[model samples]
Target: MYSKVVMDHFKTPRNVGEMKDADGMGEVGNPVCGDMMNIYIKVEDDHIKDISFLTFGCGAAIAVSSMLTDIAKGKTIEEAKKITNKSVAEALEGLPKNKLHCSNLGADALQLAIKDYEDRKAGKVRPPARPEDRHEHTHGESCKCPYCNGDVNAGLEFCSHCGKEMNDSH
Candidate 1:
């Protein structure tokens, strides 16, 4: 199941709309399940000064989006990028296995949004579409956060599971 905060967000999400001039924006959706979430970020001096989300799906999706925005605000771009699905799940106690993918959607959306922001800053290629547009994709690629799951990324100096420092990168 989900927590009270999770449920509250699911029932009545705060900041559940879009920003006209958002600094960063991310939209994550699972094509298989048709669950989608859109998160918006307003950054100030490299910090996520304000955040919000709009999700069109189940409780897990709404909860993850709500929790992600709460966690992302006030964090630097680097720190915000480090926010993982595991962390979001932990913040909500835990999510059912089937619902676990919701965390992945949330994390991925946030990451892509921040990436979009960074790209804009560096004059990189702008996203092909608007930030809120739903792009179809599979889940669970870099989805595993080894710090809480299994093994880390290959050649990772730190555990991909726990994010703990490791002696060897290989």
Candidate 2:
């Protein structure tokens, strides 16, 4: 069952749609659930001046993206970077256990967008966005652990750095 807050957001999700001239953008998907989220942010003076999203998923995923934009808007880059899956879920008044991954996608997308913004500010050239390039591993040949963004070896059941259970969809 969804919470009232969750239902509210889902019914009338805020900040929905694409931003054509976004300063940064992030996209994430859950292969298992077929959930996808794209977040766009406009930054100014080290703050999130505007934010929006386009989500293709269940109600929970849509709500999470809406809440994430509400939470990140107007916050400084540093503050927005600290937004997490737990926080987004909590803001939604909690998601179903099965739908918690929706929160992860929302948070991860936000962080990735912020990272993209910073990267552009530094004049770092990045390749065109591609499905295979969604995640950039900091550790060579290792994927990032969704729970902690730590290095995770392929086919591992748990993250060696964070000790969290790994889901194949990540």
lDDT of 2 by residue, 117-166 (tens): 98999999877867664543333577778988987887679998889998
Model 2 clash number? 0
Per-residue lDDT of 86 in model 2: 98
User: 61-120, model 1: which lDDT tens digit per residue?
Assistant: 888888888888889988998999999999888888889989999999999889878877
lDDT (C-alpha) at residue 76 in model 2: 99
Q: What's the number of clashes in each of the models? A: 8, 0
Clashing pairs in 1: 146-160, 146-161, 146-162, 147-160, 147-161, 147-162, 148-161, 152-160
Candidate 2: worst 10 consecutive residues by lDDT? 131-140
TM-score of each: 0.71, 0.76
Tell me the whole-model lDDT of each prediction, alpha carbons only: 0.77, 0.90
